[model samples]
Target chain A: MRALDVDYMLGLLPILLGYVPLTLFMAVVGMAFALVLAALMAVERVVRIPVLDIFVRLFISFFRGTPLLVQLFLFYFGLPQMLSFLTTINGVTATIMGLTLHFSAYMAESIRAAILGVDRAQWEASLAVGMTQAQMMRRIILPQAARVAAPTLVNYFIDMVKSTSLAFTLGVTELMGAAQKEAAGSFLYFEAFLVVATIYWIMVEALSFGQRRLETFLNKAHAR
Target chain B: MISVQNLNKSFGATPVLQDISLDIQPGERVVVIGPSGTGKSTLLRCLNFLDTPDSGKITIGDLSVDAAHASRADILGLRRRTGFVFQNYALFANKTARQNITEALVTVKGMSRADADARADTILRETGLEARADAYPASLSGGQQQRVGIGRAMALDAELLLFDEPTSALDPEWVGEVLDLMRKLAESRQTMLIVTHEMQFAREIADRILFMDDGRIAEEGPPADLLDTPRDPRTRAFLRRVG
Candidate 1:
């Protein structure tokens, strides 16, 4: 509104950069948790393990069908009131939990499709060779599924980094939080928000570049 | 020896294999020829417990499993004694030809890496896939991939090999190479149950050719008798069309 404060935007860039590590940490850690949980859910869905399959389906449907912000509040605000042990949950913990559960719901579908994408013959061949179900999954299915799911997972991770901005609503002073506080102090909301957006854009662009390189590397053997 | 008793399998209401029973003496090369959808592949799959039977008994070596009571351990044990080569060459896409051969050796057989690598090398040489050892399935031609599939199966040294239409997916040019390798295995007296459309190859290599129809063995005997002499009308009709 007040002439778009270019100088203020330039000055605030480094200050915001200071929070990049924490932002990256939340996204990375959230992704790690999400990857493991998603794989289990995907496998369960594929294997269709009696009652457990239905439970996993419901969890995935609920988390995936709902918004990340509501899930965060459910973890941070609603969960503690429902369970005494969850009283230990705080802003950062709540953010991580929300990110993990919410994103896992989406990632599970991707991983499941990837697992199914592997030729059916591979499973029969692995079984014929006397591989246990666990062995088949570890040595064959999961590895191939990882290759198929990698690009999509990387995209999710980039979205996750941007999604950490929502964590500011939970009282964690991550990058966006830092930006908000700076804007409040300097009364230059436009410039502060613009600086934060630019940083996020650069980070996403770098990840996109890495995604291409990784895809090329993964597909090199198949490339004629 | 392998013995199957009263093996029955169905998909929903449609019967794929009905009360099928047979025996294979050690080192007997049994080739099964039948029309598509007649359950020839299903029969081979059931022997290895790949397609769990609705009601049956399968015994390979000392391991035996019955359809009604087959446990996971029993299925695993039976599978350990047999190898399967899929029509599409089912070599692991992520692994190299050598690794595909070595995977079962190291993981299922619990062989040390050195031993597995040695076994893989021997099999690769046997299948004439040595030059393609490091190549992945997608990079190799169909013949080479199927050779890798056979090598992977042979590396396990399973008591029996079950081949489900091994050459069906190959191009015409590649089919002969695969048939030649299979001929070599037969010459070495590897016990095998093969389902194939290559009637000529079946006639040459089979100790007994089982002509299947409607999920049952319509006729079976010495390869020469089955191929040359008159038999069941169904068998005659099938041979007339394919031979």
Candidate 2:
């Protein structure tokens, strides 16, 4: 029987902690990029502009239909070969690109649903009040949609944090990759994984708590 | 003033309004009443080009708002001059009552934030929602939400206000408050075209009454003559059923 060693787990703690900032950077940057792109996609879909809507629909379908892992490979491996400029792209950039593309597809749908959930009469009401389409979108539609999309966007961000584990495949050496390397070197797989899992659990729990608070605040504002 | 000539509208093969003609003088208060499927709402919607008429001419002041003749910019201009209050209130769910009223003033009217805030505060207070100005639509009663809706339209200082069943969604007890607000608005001599089921309010307040049936105006006249002695049998039957 293999004895459990508290010392081995303690030794791995700093190593995992060292990679925490990288994980957070990846998640935050990826989410910001995804949300901006998602907002554009949502607006395009809602207006149903000529020819552009079809292109957006195809783009959303392609990204959402494929698995994230395969998409990562396609962007990191396939794109570099197809476009020489992309060949110089670094591992972190490639991982972020993949994360943004995959998550924005899902985020776009969430935002689109939120926009559509606003009553049809609101559009008429805005027009009746003399607002141009652009003004209405900026002042009325987007603010309301943000409230509807807030919780869902937070969920995607949490998923994005967990999905950062996949960044190891692109050679970014985030927390998960660091844990994998530590396990390989020390030959204590259980100890390394257990420590990494605890870090992830704590981070996710903190984000979820923050999300709940935001949701409650938004709900109160809505009730007002 | 608004005028319509040979207005036509349809949904695919199902015609909702056909060859309708009407004219509304400045400061006129016209009430349109009809059964569920009649084109009363469609007619009101077309006045501001909310729904484009298939073939027709709608002129408000100097602006011509025919779908075939007008540019998108012209349509938007016409819409700005004509305020519309929907049956559902249509308050932006995320905004407070004051924000909802001020949004257009700031965004479209190019009013300063401070000025808009002051105007919205005054309007909200006048609507009897001063205490609930910061409240959201979900928190307010149906009557309150409708009042906010009226305040929103009024904030635009539009030339004409269109009401499409403003009190239809309110609870029975709450309906009177909204009707009372409408009556007060009428007293201000605002130009209005209202589609309503409240016969008493229409009888007491409308300068002219239009009774629509099956995509056409079955009858129209002053409220006194129309409600008491409608020219069309269809109008008489409708008033009988609703009243």
Candidate 3:
């Protein structure tokens, strides 16, 4: 009914911007842990060791099959009731744990596919030269796999930045939390939501620009 | 010297290399010529434990391993003594031409990076790939890539070189360049075993020629004798088809 409030949107911008660091911090830390976990999961999938392999498959399925929101609640609320140590974890820690586990399940498959996509000849050639399996993987296989997985991995990171918005539901005041409080008090839902959405748009676009640069850099050797 | 005795391999029930045996003296260049799928390539691959022979014994230089009971160390030792040149020039896609040669030198041989680079430079110069030392495999022409493959092998200074149709994957025009490099290696008296369809190159380079058929060595002799005279009907038929 009322025209969009420019003054309120401008005032809300700085307050919301203050929480951007928390959002970014959670995403970056979550992504770093997720990448390491995903790599281990991917290798386990590829090697298919007996018991551990089955466990990894189930872990991926459970995390990937469930909704991220429910997973966050389980970490923050459900696990605390059963596990005494988990009860000490704050809302922020719970959100990060949830993000890491959820994204790892998705990214593990991408990393595994990239690892498998490398030509079999590369494996043969590395072994033919007397390289130990570890040496070959460190020097040869993983670098090529990283190149193949780069674009997909970046998309996950971008999705992760947006995913951090869900952190507010866990009682941590990230960007979305700040936007919610400002809209509630001022009763300017439309203006506050638009500004918050715009902030996310800008953040994602910046990531996309970085992704394009990364893709070009990674693809330099492959270009004929 | 390199020797393989009682080499046996199979893909499921179909035998790929059946009781295959051969010996090459130091500085000997033995070329394997045969029809496709007859296991000429399989024989060369078995020497390095690539393709994992169902059973066999291979002795190269100071290392000896029996396929049936080979340990990880034994396979690694056997692979160290033999260099393999693949048909498709499987140079590392991530490394430069120079790094491709230097990788094993640093990792397997435990040489310093500085020392490996020096050796890689010499190998690149020998294979005429010094100009493209920084080029990735995707950017190089097939012939140039194969040349780098040869250079990588040459850098190892292994007791024997195994070539599995090194030029077969190249374009017709590019084939000559790879063959020419092999000729140069032969002239230097490198102990080499090559499997190829190029009869003329085989004749020019082999100290002894081996003709494989039905996963067995049907006949073997000096280049002129095997290529010119008929020892076995299968060998003759194979030569007639490919030659």
Segments in model 2 whose C-alpha atoms lie over 4 Å from true places? none
Is 2 or 3 the stronger prediction by TM-score?
A: 3
- lDDT per residue as tens, model 2, B85-181: 9999998776789998888888888899999999998898779999999888989999999999999998888889999999988899889889888
Each prediction's Cα RMSD?
1.9, 2.2, 1.6
| Alpha carbon RMSD to native, model 2 | 2.2
How many Å off is the CA of A203 in candidate 2?
A: 1.0
Q: Quote model 2's TM-score for chain B.
A: 0.97
* Tens digit per residue, CA lDDT, model 1, A47-137: 8999999899999999989999999988898989999999988798889889999999999999999999988888988999999988999
CAPRI class assigned to model 2: medium
State which candidate has the highest DockQ: 3
Cα lDDT of model 1 by residue, B67-133, tens digit: 8799989989989999899998888888998999999888988999999998888888888888889
Superposed model 3: Cα runs more than 4 Å off: none
What lDDT does candidate 3 reach at residue A91?
85
Better of 1 and 2 by lDDT: 1
Instruction: Look at candidate 3 and tell me the lDDT of residue B237.
Output: 86
- Colliding pairs, model 3: none
What digit string (tens of lDDT, one per residue) describes model 2 on residues A78-193?
99899999989887888889899999999999999999987777777777777788877877788778879999999999999999899899887899999999889999999899
